[model samples]
Target: MSELAEPTVDPADWTCPAPLRDQPVVVMGHGGGGALSAELIEQVFAPAYGNATLAALTDSAVLDLGGARLAFSTDSYVVRPLFFPGGGLGDLAVNGTVNDLAMSGARPAYLSAAFVLEEGVELAVVEKVARAMGAAAEAAGVVVATGDTKVVESGHGDGVYVTTSGVGLVPAGVDIRPQRARPGDVVIVSGPIGLHGVAVMSVREGLEFGVEIASDTAPLADLVAAMLAVTPDIHVLRDPTRGGLGASLNEIARASGTGVRLSERSIPVPDAVANACGFLGLDPLYVANEGRLVAFVPPSAAEEVLAAMRAHPQGSGAAVIGECVAEHPGMVVVATGLGGTRVVDLPLGEQLPRIC
Candidate 1:
């Protein structure tokens, strides 16, 4: 009989303490939704400001007045290459907020947008952004109930920055949160990754891939409806936008205090995106995807829900990439192609700053 191999070693034996590396500076990693991001929140934001509202960690604070639950989420868009292959800042600002609301298992119905335009920014350009916003709202089946616009000196702000706040209603008896993900749950990606980041980067850098690779920036209200229709037991829903799939998965694992095991071979990455990542020394898993979502569902319902997702246009490339586990709590590990395993920790720093 062959001898059994020794058990795998824990990462703590070698991993360094994250806080000691950076003492005072606020680096991009603090916003990357990985370990550093959590550190900043726990050390700076949560401690300096202690309140019941912020501690909930919900996408929106919930009020308990006669038992009606309302969801609110706000996001600021500062995407470079304001106009990219698949979308522009205007559409992104609207869709991004809508998706954030939907991720909370809420039906997005209202939005408030604020825009900061730089001086000398032509009126025609501003009008173009307004038109895009209207179209996006119509497509998502949401309304821009209120808005404000401001102009700043050219040197003070970027070309434009949009802050969008959204409100929605969560149906009774439905609960979805990152901390709710549990062992034996299945993980699903709505579609491919890296397309949006690569597309935006290519445009900003003037790199060509012989074919246009555009941002996958679209609202997820319809997709969410279909998903909840099939299985209302979804534990978590997140869009791996700014830090991509790697960061999102890491966050979920940490939040739920569970181990996540993913099969790298199962992830759906487009050919154009894979090529672009290779040429640019980037990992497709760490690239942003504006139009995709990650879902955590009961293992038994995974196949049925995956089929339903694949039937939708936004989730045509849907796949079951991983499952939650009990070991390695608060960490995520992936089975690489070469029969090796590595931790898919949150990125330590920004791979491409200001991409979004």
Candidate 2:
């Protein structure tokens, strides 16, 4: 038996896959949902778990079951500080998943909450987070029907990490997806950019502007429903979270093989956010927004959709920021204030990490 146990392993016997070869170890960017994250999903995960549903890569999986269409989505929250200016991990967990379903033109109905708690974290903090989630679910008009809990060693886990999954019903006539974006489509943003990211960064780093910037951590399901009431033919819908508006546009462009031309001056950047980004050498375009959405509508229906968005409180500050073009397919270009055009490419990594 001792002689049979003697065996050797070859150095060339082990190697990394294409996606992991370049970076042998996972980095923060992998979770930041940028270029590296795209590679991980498209190359590694997709191939490993190949399927039509996963390949589509929409915010939610729109499935046909029992003669009805259903939208399903899941997201995890690891924002630092647990509590931020306008929200905490609990509400973010609920709102993030709800928005994902809404992106598919679905009316969210139920959610499941899962928590990973650190061993030594205060029980009061957990109670507060749970309460916040209940309030957010009520506001979003969704129910937390099921839940789970787990505990990790104190050092292994942060205070708490919340993961939420949501299910919604997609109206029969509605069909929205990034691949549906077309040339001559109008690109509209729901509200100001950079608020959620900036708000979290300010508190984490103790940096401040003259005024406080609050996180826009509200639900957008109601807003989506309102827009659908006007027209169910919206080409695309996305909440610019990790990679922000810049990344969201690039993704849609790539998926649809279209070009987007943005008016830099037309994009709404709040004064507080603008000032803070400038001081910190950051681009407001690449900053994350939790409670905002970017919609692409056909030119013929743009006006009606914009009006519908405006009528909703969540989309009060909506604006037409750009248009999809046919000239340079699969690219994003911005008309700068300097009377020049520049490419607004997807970032390689995150500028601010763990904000969402």
Candidate 3:
């Protein structure tokens, strides 16, 4: 038998993949809102900008301005195809920022939009996006108070990219943050998961799963308001967007220095989404969701908060999926359907990239 040739790269290196800290060039994972994304922020951005506010790492920055608290956030959308089943770039741009601000229990009021368009893109396309943005802002009760536009050379850019920045007023006595999660906090999810990621992937990959999968891209401000109406003492609120439920839970667990216990069967994963993910060999837990939120509420307020969520249109499918625990702090464990528990760790990178 011929001896195997020496491997070109070290086999030991392949055993454990390179960490984000060792990568000199920025990879797509850096933007994925997972372990890599967190590393990028902690190792690079956070150190460079060292401040108490940035250190909080909340979805929105709560600023004390003139004795009034303001929740501010910004997000960029580069989702391919621009338009997908149920929504488009404009909708994602507006709703994303609005939800971020709302996560902090804020009443979103103003938005600033910026666009970078390719030179060859048609004006009609731009107009369509603008109209969508306008309609979304209106739906969210926010205004596009200011905006800027720029056109890049045809070959130098994607069709279009939109960035939305928003500001909202945070009510007093409301202190929602990932770090607020405690052992007894009850976890709630707004609706079915994995819809948006599957919806976008189906369109982009031109795959048919025997059933239509539409993006769950809607403004969650009103739904959040409804929940707040029940109680402002909500411990934590997170919009599971890019990294999905798994990453969001991992982030919360780490931030609060608590363990998270999830019931696999309790998570609301639509049949269509489940089938699609099964066929695509993807995990529903890590799929992106544009419109859903994960909330951590104290046990005393959990019932009322969940009821309020279910009463809202956006939260009609809300469900209590898990709770925080003291065991295995900074980790997430799920009770599997097969009567076994499994650890759900943070994703190293994005599973579905270019997805808003």
Candidate 4:
């Protein structure tokens, strides 16, 4: 009898990082659970998503949910121009959910996706979105334990809309929230802002600003992880998405019953995005961003957290933008670059509608 052939090992146990590069922008085929899908998950998703529960290669990640604590957050995505300059709706859905949980000082664990599709939509497009959602969840080390899909008449529903909810576990002794800000507390941004809003508007308005400007839609899990490592005593964490920094600060000020003072020079805005805002009569402060975040921390721990933020790739442009003040409680004041001051009030309505 011929000797039995050696048993073949499973691909997931190889422990080698997936090798995929030079792939063009995402397409419908990439979302299918075939070679392209595997490549996408292994290469882009697995690296940043380092966690034992997620690496199991199972349909759902089995999180030990009985840990220190849990935080739950949900958001609906109805952004027009589903496909944008730097990211599509798939990645945005994932990032938005992850950032919400991160804002609670929690490590996001599980996610649920609900899809509303317009009838006659291409199966290829739906598959692509599903694939992107799966890949995004894998990268964030979260799982889609459950999901639902509904089909609507062609004109009734937009092309597609996704609602995602996430649950996370907050480490013991972590207290990050808007109400924690004190007069001496400092404000810091994770990175450059306005990229996402400007990118989407660029595509919609068909205006090109001479150079390619893409959305900054990225997960803040790793960046938050690093910040927590340095100092878990953060005051607040928020992703300025729909309303941007102006709205976020106003919310925090009102929540904490404290006033905030910001310096225009300290905030970091890319020249291209700034120019776009100027041309369109848009204030960069109120423009949306997917990848950036704002943090409030005690004055003492501010430098440490800022250093940790700057060392990370996503927060390379991080800077301390402002500080809480005792005067003008529940308001935000901005010291302009031209030796003037202005109230950075929340816009009564959407400044750049559908930009997110």
What is candidate 2's lDDT per residue for 15-49, written digit by digit as tens? 42224445555667777767877888888888898
Query: lDDT of all the models against the reference?
Result: 0.84, 0.91, 0.92, 0.80
Candidate 3 accuracy as TM-score: 0.95
Kindly list the per-residue Cα lDDT of model 4 for residues 1-356, writing each as its tens digit. 34796555564454322323543345433432223444566667777787543333221222345554667777778777888888888888898889888887788888999999999989888888788888888888889888899999989998889999888888887877777878999999988889998999888899999887999998898899899998888888888877688878887887688999999998989999999999999999888889999998889989999999999998988999999999899999999999999998865445556554
The lDDT, on a scale of 0 to 1, for candidate 1 is 0.84
lDDT of 4: 0.80
lDDT digits (tens) for residues 177-277 of candidate 1:
88899999999999988998999999999999988998999999789888888878889998888778998888788879999999999999999999999
Where does the lowest 10-residue lDDT sum fall in candidate 3?
Answer: 9-18
What's the candidate order when arranged by decreasing TM-score? 3, 2, 1, 4
Badly placed stretches (over 4 Å) of model 4 are 1-68
Q: What is the C-alpha lDDT profile of model 3 across 6-102, one tens digit per residue? A: 4355434443334875555567777888888888888888889987688677899999999999999988899998999999999999999999999
Best by lDDT: 3
Model 1 regions lying over 4 Å from their true place? 1-25, 28-31, 52-66
Q: Output the number of the TM-score-best candidate.
A: 3
Model 4: pairs clashing at backbone N, Cα or C within 3 Å: none
How close to the true structure is residue 293 of candidate 1, measured as C-alpha lDDT?
Answer: 95
Q: Which run of 10 residues does model 1 get worst, by summed lDDT?
A: 12-21
Total clashing pairs for each candidate: 0, 0, 0, 0
Please report how far candidate 3 places residue 90 from its true position, in Å: 0.6
TM-score of each: 0.90, 0.94, 0.95, 0.80
Arrange candidates by lDDT, descending: 3, 2, 1, 4
